[model samples]
Target: MMSSCAHPLHGKSVETQHKTAATTSQQEKALADIAAETQTTQPAPVAQNPLLDGLPASDIAGVQADAKRIYSNHWGPVSERSRYVRARILPILKDMGAPRQLEVVPVAESGYNPYAFSPVGATGLWQVMPGTARMLGMNAAKGYDPRRHVEESTRGGVQYLQEMYAMFGNWPTAFAAYHRGPGNMTRRLAQHPWKPQDGLDTMPVPPVTMTYVRGILGLSALVQRGLWTFPEPWETHQVSIEGPIDVNQLAEAAQIDPEELYRFNPGLNHSQYLDSQIVLHVPESMLQPLLANAGQAAPEYVHAKVRKGDNLSVIARRYHTSVHDLKRINPDLSTLLQPGQTLLVPAGHMDSTSPPLNPLLAQGRRIHYRVRNGDNLWNIAKRFGTTPAAIARANSIKSDKTLHPGDRLWLLARARTS
Candidate 1:
């Protein structure tokens, strides 16, 4: 059930109030459930030095205190869920060579929302967008949603941020580029260069990106001071798949929910997994068969010569498949195809046991809203005729009081019974 204050914005913006009126929006109700869970549960205290059992006493105590504080602060409102996501991402942070302190701040910056996006189109919990994600080999598709995969997304975020640092020669510039694409910052820095004394203050950036840096800094300070709490460490296992596979198919093969798969392997594209090896994360219970099947041969495709006016979408439609499937089966097909060039198209029911196809249509509809400057949760919620809590609930948001410009919030209908 929604909170008693759920219907607070009865007269808000009609255009944005589809959560109550649209029928096909299942994500809205799911987010509502998340909000309810956030309001009711109190998370257990996370161990501060997961790695401290063998450490010196002095180090153990300091690590423990830092862990506790970061855990607490990280769980501003939705402690349990926030902690869950933080725990999932902890290993990734460690793998990225992030200090314990740096790990906690990202949880704060993202509030555990894996799909967070910046105004300049950066996406994921780490806010990596399509272009950057592609460069890092993180594919975004229906069954293989890379944005939801903590390990891939976090690793890509680290790499992207490091690249930004190399470009601007400073953490602040790197972070600013994270919020407002590196291209924008590079242009600005070239036109209005800064002195050592000016620091980040002299850089020409949007107020929201500026505040994003501050937010990261604030989170880093709090976490460093041992002011937040973290979630319990959930065991992570690897699932390997071979050949042309789709994430949803792999999820079914493992007998786990697709959402769970996405949560762990957010770097996957939705439509299909190309004919290459991929290691996905899953609970320990579902790891065996996935690994065993990793050695199986990928489905072979027939070489079909391309004709004029042949696009992935059209070709996929002709073959009763999706553009994603086409892309996966034919990774060599560039955007511009030659008239006589051959492309590998999946033929027949080779993988009949796999999940139902048409993932493109299945995951088709989405609402994307651009974040405006000086916008807050209250204004956004009011604009949507939804409470701040509802908006927060929908987006895995912890605090219903803060926001950043260039941020994108996905809205769906909660009460539209279709």
Candidate 2:
């Protein structure tokens, strides 16, 4: 919980556990293992770190001391959650052309806990109010709040920060304006203006606002300084569609968990939908498959030649498009057809691949072979990169189906789910 901000949580207490020798060793080894396994190198620091944004945080006596104390105590336990938070935001900040330093703003706002909610109606890592989220281009309706999505919320937060900076002409003031509404700041300035020599915290703003800005700036410093060991960047890639897409189908074809997909694309409506376009970030390995599936699943179509005996109904079914859509895309398709003529049509499932059948599905590959001596399902599965259950299912046999030397069986390959 934040020491001060939208909600003070002043009476709330945080829990911490001391690490035993065994757990400490485990943590060190885990860190080393992660370092070895990570594919991403450290990102080069830009001339201007967004984390600093060259802003002076509150120098009030409590600010510095409280920030340090908060950092030591709040982060005393498992660092995995902290790593997850950093991993999600770094890519977003880079993509937005915002400072990587700006990432800790979410942590300051809500500990980068997307599900964190406040009675004040603030929600998500950025702790944006529903009204503010909507105003800043985030969909927060129907319990499908995109603000809860890490990337989407980062985009919204970045946009808001940019607006604040553009208006205030300085990062400190921009940060102040973000925590306290611009109108409130303006009104406060009108009532009691301070000379340029006087720092901002001296102004007639609430102490909470000052603490908010200070926390964000101080937390950003802690993260950058290696005092907090943020995780390595995630190994992932993203695709930007020209328009909004059916992310569910795209997730299914890619074989990724749908919830994970939503986590990467929180800009979509939280509930049913509110109609808008957004990007899709997926694991680096699944990028190509997702793109290929998206292309095939897209409403767009390809051309197919009509074979002999292909009537309108037959052609419509051949392509996965409706007969009405066929007529619309290809005018007079319902009225006329030639055996060898090409026509526009939605992509068929077979057309999803460059060739309708891979070499594995060719007639030569389909030819059944009799079970050989010493052959087992494991060996067959290894040979074909398919599961034994898939092979048994094809022949309508039990998973434990035993094979004898004269038994004929068909081999069907299966794609591995990511």
Candidate 3:
């Protein structure tokens, strides 16, 4: 039967009661490990200067007003939602080499509510469109949108942000592109190119897009400056299941309430049984019991050395597995693969007939490039068909900063104009 459990994070949500068991020594150790990994620390200090440059006094006042409104009226729901997912989402953003400040994008997008659905077909914590989800290598098939899956959707959202950053060459423009369509942003920028000195206020984009960018920046600043706070993150660990398993049976085996299991796994809500390999996030204390009762043999893992031209997609395809599975097993995997780095993949014979790489992903492959004399973000972006903002973001440098010869940068193979 489909789980009728209401999400605990949502308003008036039904609470799922689970039986409490005494903490065994092994489970206690596991919980400690999870705490060390997932607990939130005091955030790094925020820069005293405003996030965006060249804003007039009017724009500055507007942003402060927005931030105040969010802090006063929306903190309850936003903080509750953010606390649930912040621990998990932060690592994904870090893996993508995105600025830690971007973690608040979901807070601005959907208040970090995974089930949040917009009238225009945007869904999930990131409010990603179905078409955009597919472009990011998600399964957006009928009755099964991985966009609702917290981990999968976060990866897709970050990928989209990275793509937009590549196209526009800066966070404000990228945020605008994410809100409006990239095509529209491109046309608008062509008519009025972004000048660093002029700031985001000068952009001829839609008011809503401008508001969206401002909101994200404002919210980020509040949290960083200790004016706002999120509750402690719920400690959980992602466990991979290799094949179909009935929900009731699986929950019983793990000694968790069915409703609780359903609450943690919204992407599996469409069916009673998970018919394919998938990742499940379980409470940290339940990790050992779940593994003990799994009934199946331990999963085999194979280590693969990173190659010069390799990416998660290429490695996953070769192993006949999905990138999600690869990431679940290797929690520390970065979006940019470095030669000689090792990764753990689910054991499978190499598939010579592996399907072609997704076209969208093929265009997004990254390569390490050494900076040469006279090379700058603009020239490098032009050569790679990306933007100066994109090069700067990937390399964690200011777009207008001078590049020194022998410095290294990671460049996307080719950014899609669309």
Would you estimate the TM-scores of all the predictions?
A: 0.46, 0.46, 0.54
List model 1 lDDT by residue over 214-247, tens digit each.
4554344434333444446556666555656555
lDDT of 3 by residue, 95-178 (tens): 766666677777777767665544333556777665576566666332234766777778777777777766665566777778
The local distance difference test score of each candidate is: 0.49, 0.53, 0.60
Backbone collision tally, model 3? 1
Give the distance in Å from residue 401's predicted Cα in candidate 3 to where it truly belongs: 58
Q: Candidate 2: where are CA atoms >4 Å away?
A: 1-64, 76-79, 85-88, 139-144, 194-197, 237-418
* Tens digits of lDDT, candidate 2, 1-418: 1112532200111112212211245434643443343325442321133433322222322333556666556554323444444566776666665666676676667665554544333556676655575576664333244555666567777777767666655555667777877777677778887421254456566777766766766665445544455656455565755432345555677776666665444433321111334455566766887777764334344456778888888876766657888789887664567766777665433342121111111222232646768777766664443567767887898878788887877764321110
Residue 162 alpha-carbon offset, candidate 1, angstroms: 1.5
Which residue pairs show backbone clashes in model 2?
A: 51-101, 144-270, 144-271, 145-270, 146-266
Give the local distance difference test score of model 1.
0.49
TM-score of 2: 0.46
